[model samples]
Target: MKNLIRTFALVTALLLPVAAAHATVLTETGLAESKVAASETYRLNVPTEKAVATTQVRLVIPAGVAVTRFQVMPGFTRTVETNADGLVTEVTWRGRIAPMEYARFFFQARNPEQAGTLSWKVYQTYADGSVVAWDDTDPDNTPASKTTVK
Candidate 1:
């Protein structure tokens, strides 16, 4: 009985990280089924699960969505890239998210006039210089957060 219990404990410990890796790392709120062509404030929730601090976050604005403003976050510098049409296509925030901590960034944007899903592709960089692209279909890694417009 002692040996069996020890084996079970070891298995549980080994599986914890796997379970965590599959968990959602980036969560988006306030954009679900928003009205078409309507402006809304959206929030992206970022959590750092690494031992090292998170150094940077980049969000790729989906096509047809026009981002107009950003709420400045303390301790972070914000940058925006625009397309030829002068619409913001990318927004990046440079800050430090300590180990086991999280941060929320807010922005206002006009939803697409047509009804469809918008997939928000985000990339997270750690202090160690490693990056994770949240554009995958696999849940084991980070996946793109999506919202629909009606």
Candidate 2:
């Protein structure tokens, strides 16, 4: 009994930090690995991590990826910024994600022809007027989501 109890404690101590480091408020799915030049649909899962509701979310499209379409999320308004060549550079969703609730936004885009990593920067704003930028390169810092083109 003593040995089992000690092992359990040791395992918990070793795994807690790893779990914490990977805790993300905004997670993305789909398009993890896709063929070059393929049109893929991706989903961004945003959770209200704070006590207040999330009021807005902005996503900065990385170079080489051209976002062509977006899915309408209920209660949210979608907006975009275009470049000179008529390409989308940024996408923003305005709505209220109540405390302890989550929302998912979907979009379709064409992957670049070249094989590389596309890092997506996202900013989450709370109703209290605070913003969380998911642009870090480190995992523990709420880094932006990345997709690899094969």
Candidate 3:
């Protein structure tokens, strides 16, 4: 009985990380219009799970889209960097989000003229200096949170 119990505990420990790897990104408001050339505003909420304090968050905007405006929630500092074509390439937020806490970010942008799906890639840094990336470039790798523009 003791050996069986030990084996069960080992299996549970191994599975914990896999279960915790899934992260969630949610929109505050309901779904937005998925039409091309449509103007949409998104309020994104990102929650931290295993990290004690989330120190930084980075988001990459999809090509062909224009980020007209963006704002970080109060208590955090934000910086926006644009590409040579004047489109927002990346948005970085520096703040503290305690474990189980969430950070809010808002942005308004126009969808690309073409109809398709846009993947927003995100990377997060913890107080311990570890990093978690939400890169969906390769489907086999971590899947990125997506927005569809039909």
Candidate 4:
């Protein structure tokens, strides 16, 4: 009985972190439809469920898309890095988000002239140094956000 109890406790301890991490929800809002048009400016708002500081977010833009402007809302310091193609590759924000509080990051981009769905992958890093990858090709694996161009 002692061994069984000990084993159960050990298993629970090892899985606690994994369970807590997934409990942290990262969701985006304000963008309607999975479709967008060329040269259109879209806003993406990411909200966090837990109190966190020093949140790093990376947004991968599709080829031919250009990020014209980007900004993080007040109360937070932000730094943006772009690729040679003039697309914003990553955006990092440092600040404190109270439990259930949200941070908004805005950006303007010129979409590709061609009409197709753009898969935007987002990677998030929490204050605890835990990284959650929102990039998954499979829908069952936290698939990337998608927007289709008309």
Which one wins on TM-score? 2
lDDT of each: 0.81, 0.80, 0.76, 0.60
Candidate 1 positional error at 142, Å: 1.8
lDDT per residue as tens, model 3, 1-150:
999999999999998766545333433464633679977776655678664888898888888778898754788899889877777899889989899777778888888999888877888888999877877655455567777788
In model 1, what are the clashing residue pairs, if there are any?
none
Q: Ten residues in a row with the worst lDDT in model 3? A: 19-28
TM-score of each: 0.79, 0.81, 0.77, 0.66
Q: Kindly list the per-residue Cα lDDT of model 4 for residues 43-139, writing each as its tens digit.
A: 5445554466436666666676677876547777777777765567666666666546555566677767677867767666778887666666455
Name the lDDT of candidate 2: 0.80
Instruction: Give stretches of model 1 more than 4 Å off.
Output: 1-31, 137-140
RMSD of each: 4.8, 3.8, 5.5, 8.2
Cα misplacement distance, residue 118 of candidate 1 (Å) = 0.2
> What are the runs in model 4 whose C-alpha is more than 4 Å off?
1-37, 51-54
Clash pairs, model 4 backbone: 34-148
Candidate 2 is scored at a TM of: 0.81
How many angstroms is residue 99 displaced in model 1 relative to the true structure, after the best TM-score fit? Answer: 0.6
